[model samples]
Target: MEQGRAQNESAELGGNGHDFRPCQSVNFTVHRVGKQGTKLQELDTPRGLACSDTSCFVVDSGNKRIKVYGRRGVMSGLFSSCQTFSVSNSYWDFPTSWSPQDVAVDSSSADGDHVVYVTDLKEKVVRKFSHSGVYCGVFSDQMLRSPSNIAVDPLNGAVIVTDRESRQVALCKPDGGLIRRFTVPGVPRGVTVSPKTHNILVTVEGVSQPAVYTPEGQAIGESQEHENDVLDHKAADLGDLCVDEEGNIIVADRRNSRILLFDPQRQFVGTLLSRKDGLRDPCGVDLLCDGVVVSDLEQHCLFYVRPGVANTSITKPSQ
Candidate 1:
């Protein structure tokens, strides 16, 4: 059975010598106050967030829309009070009843175009749009029942989504063509693609342990490898997760009100951020070039945290 051995060859099966130990109390401070400026820029129950080199896309769940912000925290466009889109096309009509649950950015195109994939939990559909918020099209799959979380493969542009109602995970192309689907034991919550290995990391709804699988849906390790000390599978309230450049998994432990870390081999590393560091029920997390941005439900704001760095504040609006 040829499982794309060459692709898997470069992927390290273990941590790349990164010491999986707890760091000393690092300084954490409020880097950005709210999403942007003004009351409208403020976030209300923001759930899904993803970042790129220049901007951040946040799932403004309460507002039933997605908000885009620059690296310096300025509102981009489309959803702002001053800007409006040409809704002449029926597909571009206002999404008053849509409830966006998650968001991800795909930049693996030959022409270097970035596409944003957003999941509408209320309508059970995944929608695609340009980075500037132009409506593209729906995922249009019958298997996408109650799509919860979504992720994009940076190397191939494959979108992975968990269908809670179907109790399975579906791998689709950027245009929503079904490549394959596989069932898991428990309800899947958060799903992410490992940056170094390209493996799919999935967090179960009621299980603290997360499972890993190859792109072809082959389980990566023993059952014990999925269990960890930092993850609260019992609470099963884990939110969205992202892989760092160092191959570490940063998961939003919503039930514990902190973020947990794990090595590439699915080993428990340590607590990366928590309430002690000023996080309250953090939902979505994404790594920026300079720092990390977390969506906190209790605070109703995005907390910017930098590890092992002196505390500083950036109050200037993005230019």
Candidate 2:
């Protein structure tokens, strides 16, 4: 991965060793993949993003497939709908077509292998896949209307799906049994499970702020205002979101064409990437060990960004 230089911008924070003073902007090194073609590295309307320790998964929505990339941004593999039919299944009950909108990876298995869960908007079900892209089975057909996005709980391997038509988030077992469902204010777009606190983070359509919920469906918190910002800190169009191990929330603000950072308390930190960084309608994001992988719809590509705090010592104050 080629390293890019960090662009400096001023930001303020309160307490937690991040005082309300002008500190150096967050640093980032970006690596991107894909172009306007049908190659393995090319993408079409890439939407949902999820990352395991070794690979990042992209929901190539327009292509009706999922593309996998290694940590260094190399194209690894891809998988599309399976057409195998069961003898016991009726003609109409067989898998005909699929439109995948989002994907999630479960890497908490005891055997060290990861499992993939993909939400099919056309089928209204979540399909399971092995780590290397083997079709396992489909689940949640009876519970979802139009499944848009999905996530896996690291603690228990529960699959959480956001049903757009139902305006609900359904938590299901790995085997596809429904555990419970909760209603959100608007059409839920993105859903993810936090590894640190085990809380669920969800983004709703037309809602400027992301909402936090407990695993048991209790409302907890939403994005809060930043003290120093004169403009509204809320996102214009929110998309997929993921929480790092430290509980820091990374959100894809689509309309704003940028990626936002929020503390564990959902307080706005700052813009990590924006239009200046070549983003045009970023729709999905997932965290890597040292950075994040983002899917841009308009750009039709994926970006791996490693973020860092700028060094205040070398930064010159604006005069």
Candidate 3:
């Protein structure tokens, strides 16, 4: 594809007063992980994904464990819930049955250690873990019914969680203290914070676009429209999402098997990847320095893609 920026265009503003500019077309090189697995590379129904500067974490939902991988896609470590008991006066070990839904990494500790937060669907709480997989504690509240996705605030280190059953979002302190809670328009699927604006971006089911909110639980803006002519769908089954430093939003359209990009002003830029890119049920997404990481539930793997500036292009889904 030809590589260049489009002609300069006039800036526009959205309902939230965000300055919008023309979006540049880009091409992405996709890489697959866990397709040909080692013992540690095998995954099943992986859901949530989060990354720090040095490592990426995957909530291996089917395996009932959290897998850690280095930037180069090598498995560094893993941890799971375990229980010990005494049977016939002998010690017996068994795995704990817990449903881990999503994960978020907090890299704001003063000691330079990253904290991992995982939402437990079965327990209805958010469990905390150290960078090395040690259980720290958990964040629990009567208001949280089904915590599905989570994110951390870049400005204040607050943990944000979305509950689909409750149809609400909660902002909490680093230690899991509830700061505030507010209801959303629909079932919330994903939650994220823009590193540049600190604005919370959430994907709600039945809503055609991701909703934007202020840190104080005030609704701000939403994408005016979606570029969905290729899919011929009126609404997108949005899953997880993340924002880059430039404030661009990367969203996982699970039902369409595509990843989408939106400018800071919540304007649909273009499709980043689709089913042609070997994505099957892209459920979770996180922004990396080089590109973006996506978790495919149906494929039971992850995709690391390095996107670059190129002539705008969109691929139609295979028949």
Candidate 4:
């Protein structure tokens, strides 16, 4: 295994003479095996991933379908092919075709159900489906044109989507009724609900900063320290983001080929995943209590990284 840059434990100090930020070094191992190879379970241009307690869902964008991989055991690691399934139909009730762009898991239904919400760029809607590959319905609205990314509010089961062409974020009820839409300061790319404050966090194109909004579509504030000012056409740009259990926002920094870590207050902590850590154009990220699973667009496969455990051995890629 290759050694990465040694961590700076005393970095990121505040006036109080203490460092509150998480370490910048990656403390996890990497696992590359997924439903690929000669077995015919090839993933084409995987762009999104979402995780639950027992499984990880991948949006095989180019293939126009979602792939579900079940967790084998506590120590079995991520994206095991032993128990897996795929969803191609638009909804469980209808056999319509779909071109999925991103995906999110909503388990906050009134009765506590786990429903998978995927953004269909072709249909311009967020499609709801059960965990077992049963499509429920579409969160349709006339204003939703070119739905790019989605995030589900675990507190209220509301679905939030970033409409790139419209330059706005739409908040909708679980049944697909529009609550309200907030205009993004710039073109919105990725959006996620902060688990700590339940606030809507959005990453805009050509802007290094992220905007924070309330669930009611009210502006809270924008992050100050995350300003990278990278051009939209630049090689290194922002990708999809997700909130970890600790309420920190994990961002996929594409061109940089790494994952960025920020706290609830939107303060930059450090780099979580990077090229030195074996990530290349990692576009989609999802967290687990023990680790994270990311979708590599260039590699066309899912990888598992165990954060917080330094010098962990890298797993060999599957045959």
Better of 3 and 4 by TM-score: 4
Clashing pairs in 2: none
lDDT of 2: 0.71
TM-score of each: 0.79, 0.80, 0.79, 0.81
Ranking by lDDT: 2, 3, 4, 1
lDDT of candidate 4 at residue 229, scale 0 to 100 = 42
Q: Name the candidate, 3 or 4, with the larger lDDT value.
A: 3
lDDT, model 4, position 12: 26
Off by over 4 Å in 3: 1-27, 36-38, 72-94, 222-234, 307-319
In model 1, what lDDT does residue 267 have? 66
Total clashing residue pairs per candidate?
2, 0, 0, 4
lDDT of 2 by residue, 14-97 (tens): 211122222344455566777654455578788897877657778777766777765432222122222211111221122237
Candidate 4: residue 259 lDDT (0-100): 73
lDDT of 3 by residue, 49-71 (tens): 98776467888787667777764
Candidate 4: how large is its RMSD? 6.6
Q: Is candidate 1 or candidate 3 better by lDDT?
A: 3
